[model samples]
Target: MKILFFDTKTYDKESFNKQLEHYPEIEIEYLKADLAPRTAPLAKGYDAVCGFVSSDVGSETMDALREAGIKLILMRCAGYNNVDLEKAEEYGIKVMRVPGYSPEAVAEHAMALALTANRRIHKAYVKVRENDFSLSGLMGFNFYEKTAGIVGTGKIGAAMAKICRGFGMKVIAYDVHRNPELDFAEYVSLDELLSRSDLISLHCPLMDSTYHLINRDTIAKMKDGVILVNTSRGGLVKTADLIEGIRARKFFGVGLDVYEEETNNVFEDRSDEILEHSTTARLLSFPNVMITSHQGFFTQEALAAISGTTLDNAVAFQKGIQNGNEVSA
Candidate 1:
């Protein structure tokens, strides 16, 4: 079977090639452009089309893929929020994704952001670089005796829970679907999680129900001077609510690896241009805010594993095997 891989990056090509070595019979075609309305026709003559998180796989793209005779939409990443799974199902295209590639990679990054924000490490490092060893405005408290609430108990949340435990923190979690493995964590209600946790980390996927899961009401319910960390989908937290919370000092420190309106903004060239988006600019104005461009899954190990697993799932689906990760919408 032939597979057309869209939005091919340097790392994607390297990792995909290494993984495809296990399936020599499958033919691969690489396309560097994102899967959009115009680029969807490029999947012609291929049985399947594979893409990443940034690619648009909505109704228009799905129709174009159907026209191109592509039967499968394979995502090399865990989050399928960018893909219109309902449209894919309408087009009779099966969707597959690589879930749980490296939860530790993302969980560890979330912890790094939390620590950096809470401890004011960014400010101190810059000061030290200028030969100024002053310690004002860098007073950070100990993580010990702190209460940490993880919003999702998936693989990443479980990993973060263990890390918080290692810091001598009491960990509580809230998830619609509970994991049997995370027995140490008490599965509390969302309100209880908000009111008690000193540090709250988000690791849930973005869906209709989960969109803006952390909003004004939730922020109002949270502990005062709380630390917020997000390494999950951008839409999970409402940007306006976050800004209001920060402005009121309800959030002591905000660490974000993703933003609500990050598309066409994050991981792109903007050094020579004036900054757009007043919310983002205002976010940067705060001393306790730390923002990263959605890079929690950028680790070498995670990328490699994601490519391999996605390719394997796609190949298995084509060979009439049941892929556990296949989604029907």
Candidate 2:
């Protein structure tokens, strides 16, 4: 099977190439070009086209994919919000993804971001490096005995709950289906999670019900001076409302690995360029706000797992075997 890999990054090439040696039936040609309507035609004569979270496989792209004779769409990442699944079905293309590469990797990053934000470690690191060791603004409370609210209780959220428990924190979670394994986490309503938690971390998927889940009304329901961290989908929190909340001092510290306005900016360097129109730029101006370029799943273990699972998904498709990774509209 010949696969056209779009938006190929240095790390992706390294990891996938290493895994490719084990799969003699699979042939992948890496390209820096992203998957879009214009670029969809580039997949001609290929059995499948692989893309990441940044790839746009909308209606026009799906039409072009059909014209190119591509039958399969492989998302190397977990999230498929960028893909039009209904259009994929309409065009008779099967879509598959690596659902859980390394839940521990993302869970660990969430805790790192939460700790960095709440303790003002980012500020202290900068000050200490410049020989300005005054602890005037570095005051922070301990996480011990604090109430931590985790939004989702999937593998990742369950890992987060375990970590919070390790920190001697009281864990409360809000999810449609509670994991019985996370017995340490007290199942609660969303409103109660907001009002009760001292630190809140989002780990839920982005859907119609979950989109903009943390807007003005939700923020108003949260405890004052709550430390919030989101390592999941960016659309879950409304950016404008978050900005307003920050201005009103609603959050003690905010750590984000994802944001809605990060579409054009994620995994790219714009260091010398001006970002006058970017909400991310506005977010960077806040002292308590810390943002990373959606890299919560950047660990070596995650990369290898993603490479293996993606190839396994391809193999499943090639052999007419239905894998759990197959997603539908």
Candidate 3:
């Protein structure tokens, strides 16, 4: 089976090349261009196409892929909100993804973001580099006994709950389907979690019902000086409302590894270019707010797992074996 890998970065190529030797049946041609309508045509001679989180795999791109005789889409990452699953189904394109690459990798990043944002480490790092060692604005509260709210109880969320418990924090979670093994977390309602949590970390998926879960009304419900961190889907929080919350001093510190406007800037160095009407630019202008390029699942372990599983998925599809990674609309 031949695959057209799209939106590939240096790390992607490096990791995938290491795994390619294991799967001699699968062959991949890497391309820097993202999988969009225009680039989908390049997959005409390939069996399947691989894309990252930032690839545009909507109806138009699916149309082009269908015309190109492509039948499978392999998402190396866990999240598939960027792909139009309904359109892919209509086009007879089977979509598969690595559901859980390395839960500990993402959970560790979430903990790092929460702690860094709460303690103003990002700012302190810059000040100390300039030989200005001052503790004027670096004052932060202790997390030993604080309440931590986790939005989802999946593998990653469960890992986060374990980490929070290790910090001597009270872990509370709100999920539609609760995990019985997540005994450390006290299950609660969303409103109660929002109101009671001193540190809130989002770990939920992005769906129509979960889109904009953190908005103006939800932010108003959170406690004052609460630290907000998101390492999950970007669409879960409303960016404009988050800016408003920051302006109103609702959050003590905000750390986001994902945001609504990240697609345009993901893995790209736009440092020299001036963005016009960019929400990401607005988000970056604030000192208390921090954002990463959706790299929560970027650990070496996660990358190796993703590369192995993606090729396994392609091999399974070639043999008409349903390995349960198939995603449906």
Candidate 4:
């Protein structure tokens, strides 16, 4: 069984090779390309193609893959929004993904973002480096006794709620599909969570129903000076509405690991050039906003788990095993 890994980075190669050593019988070859329609011809004779979050697998690319005789589409990450699943199913291409790698890695990053943003840690660190460590504008509130609203109760969201509880915070959660395991965190309606929470953290997935879930009306229901954190998919929060909320002082701080328009923007080398997008440029102008690229699941533990599971899924699919993470129509 031969596999063609697309969008191969140095870390991906190193980590995948190390993990795949456990299965020495399988032959794996990697191609380092964006995997669009133009590049799909590269996977000529491979049985499966592995892709990352940044790769574009639209209808054209899917058609190209079908023509290339590709049977499996293995996604290293959990989100399938970048791939057209409907078209892949239509073309008889089986899709699989690593559903949960290391929930703690992402949950920790979300908490780190919230803490850093709320306390102005980046600005304070810069000031200290410049020998101007005055206490002005560095005042931050205590996390204890604060109400934290968490959206989604998946593995990552559950971990986040536990962390918030450890900080002596009262946690309230809202999820379309509630997890019975998250009994410690009180389940509340979206409006109630927004109305009462001092800090709001989003950990939901990206689907048609969840797109731009946090818009102007939702922001209006939030507390006067709420801290917002998003380690989930970018499209969950409306960027324009968030900007307006920030300007109006409805949002005290924002810690984002993703953005609404992040295609070709995040995880790329653009430091030498001027940013052309006005929304991104404006988001960076605010002192209270800390925007990190989508790296919430970039820890070593998560990478190893993701690589191992992805290869395992590929091996299972090739061997006709009953895999749980297989994508269906």
Q: Please provide TM-scores, in order, for all candidate models, with all chains considered together.
A: 0.96, 0.99, 0.98, 0.97
Better of 1 and 4 by lDDT: 4
Q: Which residue ranges in model 4 land beyond 4 Å of their true spot? A: none
TM-score of 1: 0.96
Error of 4 at 233 (Å): 0.6
Judge candidate 3 at residue 84 and give its lDDT: 91
List, residue by residue over 26-140, the lDDT tens digit for candidate 4.
7778876777899988888888888888889889999999999999988998888888889998999999998999999999999999999999998899999999979788777
Model 2's lDDT to the true fold? 0.94
Please provide, for model 2 over 265-329, each residue's C-alpha lDDT reduced to its tens digit, 9 standing for 90 to 100: 87888998988788998998998988999999999999999999999999999999998999999
Clashes of 3: 0
Q: At residue 48, what lDDT does model 1 achieve?
A: 89
Error of 1 at 96 (Å): 0.3
Query: Residue by residue across 201-316, what tens digits does model 3's lDDT show?
Result: 99999999999999999999999999999999889999999999999999999999999888888899899998999998798788788888888898999999999999999999
Ranking by lDDT: 2, 3, 4, 1
Between candidates 2 and 4, name the one with more favorable lDDT: 2
Clashes of each: 0, 0, 0, 0
Residue 57 alpha-carbon offset, candidate 4, angstroms: 1.3
